[model samples]
Target: MGRINGENRDVVFEELWKLKIPAKSSVFAWRLIKDRLPKKLNLRRGQVVVNGTLCPFCSNNEEEAAHLFFNCSKILPLWWESLSWINIVIELPQNPRDHFLQHGNGNVGGIKSTRWKCW
Candidate 1:
């Protein structure tokens, strides 16, 4: 939520809201960027009881948003599919905010860039 490594939050949000996607998708992205989603780790932080905190997909690590979405062994292939469209692949940042920003880096500008951000 605060400035990320000096990157302005307003600019990041401005770009985020400009994507041609559904409002619910935008809301989901906003929650993801802000770490507000109810991932298992987040739920535990609020003292909400659940059956378990391990990732439901991989069952190998805590189900944090960053891990579930960006680093999970079960989810990486889906991310790779999208990255392959750009003909590039790079190490993804663990933080959701950083991952969102970096996911679209080095992309061509205009609609393509918009699509990348949306993805």
Candidate 2:
């Protein structure tokens, strides 16, 4: 995956808005990506050894980016709400990165701060 910084950041953020993923600020976008990663993958969560760490949102499996952002029931409602707030009606991407990178050209002035906070 590419770093969301410099010109790449602009490209990603603009693409995200175009994709109707939500017009949140770049900081919020970064946080959303971080939140999507599995707890095990997050070094800040501490080391994972012996029994595998499970996803906090879904105990059924490890909390990888795909699971947390795309598959977790806990996060689905948030995703739906985010899209709805932006008046975006479309199918979500299968991968978290793809979802984050989606871009659409619709008017995105309706995006809300709460949506970013939720991320």
Candidate 3:
């Protein structure tokens, strides 16, 4: 692989290995990073009917990866509460890549670092 592509893939593999979430959860996270999750917008783009393209949680805007995961009116509070319980304060990024990266990349170590990884 080219240098840049290899480096990017390395980062992804590193993150996936570091996240101590369940196997299914880690797989879900991997799909999220690849932008391969079958969100409503993705389905729509694939010519699949979704009734409405708006976000199911907020129903305020088009259903997309970033909005569904981080920017929705409903899910953000839950995410914040979960992270806040562990003493991590976060403002969800509008960008999808940034949002995924914001999850458990702290410098801490051992059990605490494992605990800090996203669900």
Best by lDDT: 1
- Predictions in order: lDDT: 0.82, 0.58, 0.73
TM-score of each: 0.83, 0.50, 0.78
User: Which pairs, if any, clash in model 2?
Assistant: 15-103, 18-103, 18-104, 19-102, 19-103, 19-104, 38-63
Q: What CA root-mean-square deviation does each model show from the true structure?
A: 3.9, 6.6, 2.8
Model 2 misplacement above 4 A: 1-38, 41-51, 105-119
lDDT tens digits, residue span 24-58, model 2: 55455555554643357675465645355577877
Q: Arrange candidates by TM-score, highest first: which order?
A: 1, 3, 2
Candidate 3 runs further than 4 Å off? 3-8, 103-105, 108-110
- Looking at model 3, residue 41 earns an lDDT score of 79
Candidate 1 TM-score to native: 0.83
For model 3, residues 1-119, the per-residue Cα lDDT tens digits are 57666754556557676765788988887787778899887888899978988887778989888788877888888888987888877677786566655554665445665565555
Clashes of 1: 0
Judged by whole-model lDDT over C-alpha atoms, candidate 1 comes out at: 0.82
- lDDT, model 2, position 109: 36
2 or 3: which has the higher lDDT?
A: 3
Evaluated at residue 54, the lDDT of candidate 3 is 84
**What lDDT does candidate 1 reach at residue 116?**
74
